[model samples]
Target: MWDTEHNNGVLIYLLVPEHAIEIVADRGLARCVAPGEWQALVSQLAVHLREGRYEEGLAQAVDAVSARQAAHFPRRGAGTAYANELPDAPAVR
Candidate 1:
């Protein structure tokens, strides 16, 4: 659930197969995150992706890139869209 209002709330759910109750208590996570901070999170996620830590990479990617700009921004294979995307390709190993 995307809570733009930044309200603190917990999501409680029951796991049938595990036969347990899952409680995601929002203590720190519910707080509003800044854009730069979020960008840093994305950078970290890319690092994680490079390191082959798939789960961490995915978490960081989703948290970082999942923004208003994501919709307008191209996923890949393009000629310039955002300023971040360089026109020239980097040297490949």
Candidate 2:
């Protein structure tokens, strides 16, 4: 989370065995987002997971988080390119 340049990194962790989800955001992003918004996203993801839609749920969660990040930390210019600081794929253990 602290590795991102904009300090807006987010991690969505899913505990499959416990059917639990956790969303961690960096300080910059956390201050801009309300707790209820995070809870709402988690609730939506939980619904999809409970229905056995793991991939769909995860994809939606990623999209939602991306949208939030974009809204809070937009690119500086239309032609500007930013490096992806985090891995694109999720690491499952």
Q: Please, what are the lDDT tens digits per residue for candidate 2 over residues 14-80?
A: 8888878999999999999999999999999999988989889889999999999989998898899
The most accurate candidate by lDDT is 2
**What is model 2's C-alpha RMSD?**
0.9
Give the runs in model 2 whose Cα sits over 4 Å from its true position: none
Q: Kindly list the per-residue Cα lDDT of model 1 for residues 8-51, writing each as its tens digit.
A: 23333334355433333243343444446545654565576567
Give the lDDT of residue 22 in candidate 2.
93
**Per-model root-mean-square deviation over C-alphas:** 15.4, 0.9
Off by over 4 Å in 1: 3-31, 58-93
The positional error of residue 76 in candidate 2, measured at the CA in angstroms, is: 1.0
lDDT of 1 at 36: 64
